[model samples]
Target: MHIVIPIITAVVGIIVGAVIGFLYRKTVAEKEIGSAEQEATRIINDAIKSGETKKREAILEAKDEIHKSRTEAEREIKERRNETQKLERRLIQREEALDKKSDAVEQKAEELDRRLAKVQKTQEESEEVRAKQIAELERISGFSRDEAKEYLVSTIEREAQHDAAVKLREIMQKAKDEADANARELISIAIQRCAADHVAEATVSVVPLPNDEMKGRIIGREGRNIRTLETLTGVDLIIDDTPEAITLSSFDPVRREVARMTLEKLIADGRIHPARIEEMVEKSRKEIEQIMKAEGERATFEVGIHNLHPELVKLLGRLRYRTSYGQNVLKHSIEVAHVAGILAAELGLDPVPARRAGLLHDIGKAVDHEVEGSHVSIGVDLAKRYKENPAIVHAIAAHHGDVEPESIIACLVQAADAISAARPGARRENLENYIKRLEKLEEIANTTTGVASSYAIQAGREIRIIVKPEQVSDDAMVLLSRDIAKHIEDELDYPGQIKINMIRETRVVEYAK
Candidate 1:
């Protein structure tokens, strides 16, 4: 009980100390709150004063900006009103100037109308005066206006014709003096150097049989042997009643020769059978080919031409069987080559190409029966394909006057061909046809205007035309010749070229009594 009393007294003392400590802390917190409230009030009053000053400054800046904008706008408007007043004054001045110009233009237009009327009156008076003068001139002169014009034009035309004729004559005389003699000399020499005999080749070849019985045998049983021979040789075996003779007919001379040889061999063998015929035909074909090859080689050797394509050489061999107007083509080609070479020599040109061209000019004739085209076209193609000289190819194309001759060699070949073909007996034509051709040539020249007379000379190779000096001016002869030549070319198919000889003679005579 004594310990409990001491503990109660100690507890009372602890409670009293706690009450005193709580009161002290509460009094300190109240003082801090009072000071914080005073600081907040001062801060709020300072912020309001600063905000009011900033607002006043912004309002003053805004008012100054508004006043400056209003002043600038009023000044701009005043300047625009002044410019508008100046533009209005300028427009009024322009309008007054235009009115003055329009009055001036109207006065000028009225004056132009009055002048135009006066000019019309003056033109009418001039016309009347011109009419009177023309009438008086017509009365004084014998001719009217149109008649005078016609007469003057005709006189002018005649004078022009005379002058042209004289000038043309002078030019032609000069040209003739320059070139005619040399051309004639060269041609004559070429012709003289190459004189070849023309043998008229028969298209059909004649074969002899031993007897009449041979024909029967060749005909064979049911004609099997004959058919086989024809089929193999591609030739017609005509077993006619011509006294132990058979004719082999084919456009291809090689085939004809083969047929002839086959027939001859079969006759000799005395074995008339299809098999025998075939065998003989084949043998004869190969033999003919060999003969042709030899002939080709011989021709090239004769012409002094080397390095010819083998195919070209073979074609030359074929010319042996070709015939033109009954003239042996091979012989003709050789003649042409000789003539061309001679001409080339005379002209100081290379004769080799001339000769080559001349020889190959008719080469196409060798294959004309097999190919489709004129011999000239075929020859050109062959020459090009064989890689011959371009000059040689051109010569071949132009040899027959199919194209214009461009080179001297081509010209030589042309002249050589003409000389070769124009030889007497070189070709054959019906006598009646010959006479008609000559007559037609003369007729063409005679029918022309101003041609007094015409005569065909040189086997229709030349036509001599005599023109009336009065009707045809000297200069007109050239034109006349060309016209007649053109007509002849268009109307007549001829060999070689025709020469147009013009003759104009003016004779003056005065008798002294």
Candidate 2:
């Protein structure tokens, strides 16, 4: 029994212990669950707080963005409104300006209408006055209105015809005088502007000898050297006592030049032998040919002419040795070219053709000595052979009034040629002959019926006659001038052109105190 009681107690003790352990474990588990629940609630609460903070921040950022967008849109709208206001202001200003302009135009139109009505009334009054005057005129003339009207018309017609005739005479006379004056001025200007030097050339070339002893050397052993030189050069060597000078006389200028050069070289080299003379003569011939070509080129260059044939250029250079009436032909031609160019420019024509024509106008004279034709015909042929412009050819042919001038350029060339030939010191004329020309011009002017006095001016280029105004009527002055010019043309042999001027003036002197 004692052993059973102890064993049972031990079993009860074991069971109670196990129940307490179970209760304790159950309480620990409940506490752990509560802690886990609190932890989970805290995590949930933290997550919700974090989510609320992020949502608020996002809302704030979105609000800021919306506010910024609204501000920008408001600024844009303000700018557009400002622009619209400016446009409206400009439109208003333009409308006001237009309205003012319309009002001004309307005012001007009203004023024009008033003036038109006033002019119409004035015209009506004038018509009434003319009608009354006509009626009175008819009554006084003891005739019907139609008959009186016809008579008045005939009278007025006669008066108008007389007035028209008088006016025509005045206009014609004025035009003639102006033309003469203008021509004189233009010619004077051309002459004044021309500054070319006038060279006087002769058929003889004078060479200076080194010494009187040299002249003996030139005459050489029995004059053989002199004879050889004269034969080769075809010139007359006149070893005269003119102070160390020998004169080479030749009708041909080229021959004279060659002889002059040959003699100069012989004198310079102190070699007067026949062989040296022949060599020098041949050399000088070549030199002269080169010189002629160079001179031709220089002339064309000076005159601004180009594209000329080589043969033509050489011929032009030959004109440098030619003389007409003591005037160097080349110099005269250059002067004529300058004058023609000037005149052509003044007349609004091409100066190139004028200058070319004038330069080549006298080219025929270069070969006229060799050719059996007039200079004009030879010039025409030369220009044609050289393929010159036809107008240039015509100008060359017509420069001397040979063939009637078919073109204005030809006429210009003729006038220029005459001007160059007629300028003072251009040509040689005896003093007696010149004085006689002036006297003849004066006498011709004096022969006119209404001449109170006569004066020949401008080297007989112009003849001025003062006429009595009472004797020579204004209309008669024109007739007198024409008659005087006609008479001079018919009877006088004047060079270049002559002007016949008739002056009819009535002096009305009034003293103003």
Q: Against the true structure, whose lDDT is highest?
A: 2
TM-score of each: 0.66, 0.58
lDDT of each: 0.87, 0.89
Model 1 per-residue lDDT tens digits across residues 2-33: 99999999999999999999999999999999
Query: In model 2, which runs have C-alpha deviations exceeding 4 angstroms?
Result: 1-169, 177-195, 198-204, 430-458, 462-477, 490-493, 501-513
Clashes of each: 1, 0
Q: Which ranges of candidate 1 are over 4 A from the true structure? A: 1-141, 144-146, 200-204, 430-458, 463-478, 499-513
lDDT of 1 at 287: 86
Best by TM-score: 1
